[model samples]
Target: MQAYQVAELTPGLGADERREFRDRALSSARNPSQFTQLREIEGYGEARLSLIERYLLQGTPDASALAAREAVALSAQASQYAKAMEGRYVAALLLMRRVLLGTALVTGLLSVTSALRALLLWRSEMDRRARREARQREALSLASHELRRPLQSLLLASDLLRHAETQEQRTHLLALIEDGAAQLASRADLTRLNDLYLDVTLRPRAQDLRPLLERFAAPRVELSLPLEPLVWPVDGDRLRQIVENLVENALKYTDGPVEVALREVGSQPEVTVRDHGSGLSDTLHGQVFLPYDQGPRGLRGGQGLGLPLVRRYARAHGGDVTLAAAPGGGLQATVRLGQPAGTRAETQAAGGAGLLQARSDAG
Candidate 1:
């Protein structure tokens, strides 16, 4: 209505007012033909048709009224477009919300499942660690117990040495002191034996075991080996430890010569350490391999680690060590290495578990 009033007042306007109106209206538009100021209005159907007819018929258009009608039509059209755009925006927002809610639900489920798996793994690791720590403490306790006797003997012998009246008694006390000191040194070796024989790696190579056995031979030990090399894929140093422990045990038990023999029987290399003294009892065959499992008091003194370490080292290198009665008398300690199945990488990869795994296989 106001646009119509303006159209009517336009005919009465001075030239300056008309110029100002045209300038303001055309300012936002490029030119008359390109200008999009007017829009088609659906509700003004009859009036728009009448204007179109009048535009076709009239020689010159009633410009002010046409501009006013176009303005009114364009305003109505713009209002309808705004309403349609608002509806589209609201629909898009609802779709996005549903998608976001589904994504969040899936992510939450994944997180929960992952947390449960991680919890189970952590619990298993903690249990394994606890068991390992318990075994270590038990070993330390056994070593401490073994060390005590040798230490007490050393102190007692030194006191006796100082108070001895006869040179013969003093000499005997000095011998006792020497023996006790040697016992302490040998027993101390057991403390560090864990890293090599138990829960550790041993890099075995194809080498001769005969020279190693012969090298440990002494005037008191009757060494017997063939003139040829007794070669086997064995951890030589650890194998030497096994030979030394067996020979030392033999010499310690008997005053007579201890016999040490090395020979290959069939596919396996065999070692026999024989002493002319009472062998371990039949009941003690299995018991002897345990840590700090000392025999009957005063039979033979030891930290009791020799047999166990011997067995462990032998087993770790895919072999076995067993104690049994000798041919004529005394205990016979034998060692044999297991045949290689694969490579050294597989051995080290197993750490100490390979020893038990192989023993289980042998059994």
Candidate 2:
């Protein structure tokens, strides 16, 4: 409309027409708000937009055409920038989704693994407790059965004593009663051995072990010891019990003479009781050390508490007991005692000659 107005105008044009054209041109120019919006974009071709703004203000036909071309170029540049930013935003969203998925998967696996491990531990503990309780029940049953026989014999012998006719008859009845009472006492001691040992503190003092072993020497049992004195700090009563139990256990299974050797190994006193009989199998060896566990032999008229008590007594004196197969096809039970300082000479002095002296002494 401005170009048409410029072409049709004559020098004699009215003042009102010129004033209306000027007002329309000003209204058609770019608004200040459009310039503010274009400037706000990050890379909206600022140089070209400024040139277009300057051309619009000139208000000539040629300048208006140039400004329109610059405006088109600015719009295309803004569109390209928008497309590139859109692609980057989409890629970032995908990366974030993958990270969240991986974290969730790892968390779930950790929770499952912890739950399974806890369940396995709980199951193992329950199984162990069940086995212990069962063993305890069996021990109680066996004890009751063993005690009944002696109790019945005692009752019968007591009734028989009341009706005795002569001196011989009374003596026989008394002997039977005495034997039954002794058996009952022995059984009671074996049954309470663990508790008794646990409660009793060891009273260790320096004592000779030769005399103690000599007391146990018999036709079926032989001894080897240092002739001078197998002196060691020990609880005499407990040490005696340890020797007696080993010897008795040896004799129970073997017909040949049992060998008892007292020697020193590495500054410690070691007593080994060996029998030339059928030794225990590998599996039975461990079982025999458990209370009331007789392994394959069951109970051969003896409580299965001896070896366990032997170990307990040994450990009380800061020692331990180990059983292994003897060189000549039997079981060898060894008692090792913890020696204090200044006992190395006595222990190492246990030479081969002690076997001859031990035999001579036994004879």
Scored by lDDT, model 2 comes in at 0.70
Q: Number of the top candidate by lDDT?
A: 2
Best by TM-score: 1
Query: In model 2, where is the ten-residue run with the lowest total lDDT?
Result: 339-348
State the displacement of the C-alpha of residue 322, model 1, in Å, after optimal TM-score superposition: 1.5
Write down the lDDT of every candidate, Cα atoms only: 0.66, 0.70
* Each prediction's RMSD to truth: 23.1, 22.9
Give the lDDT of residue 209 in candidate 1: 66
lDDT of 1 by residue, 1-363 (tens): 332335346677775665554544544322334423233333433344334334323323365456556556656666675676679888988976775665565566567557758988999999999988877775565446445656887999999888999999999989878867866665456556455445635666556666677666678988898776655667665676677677777888778898888887885688888889877787887887887776654336577777887887777866788878887878888887774434456656766466445444433
Model 2 C-alpha lDDT per residue in residues 106-213, reported as the tens digit of each score: 567567557768989999999999987776555454445445656887999899899999999999889878867866775457556334354335656566677777
TM-score of 2: 0.43
**What is the lDDT, from 0 to 100, of the residue 273 in candidate 2?**
97
Give the runs in model 2 whose Cα sits over 4 Å from its true position. Answer: 1-195, 339-363
> Which lDDT value does model 2 have at 233?
70
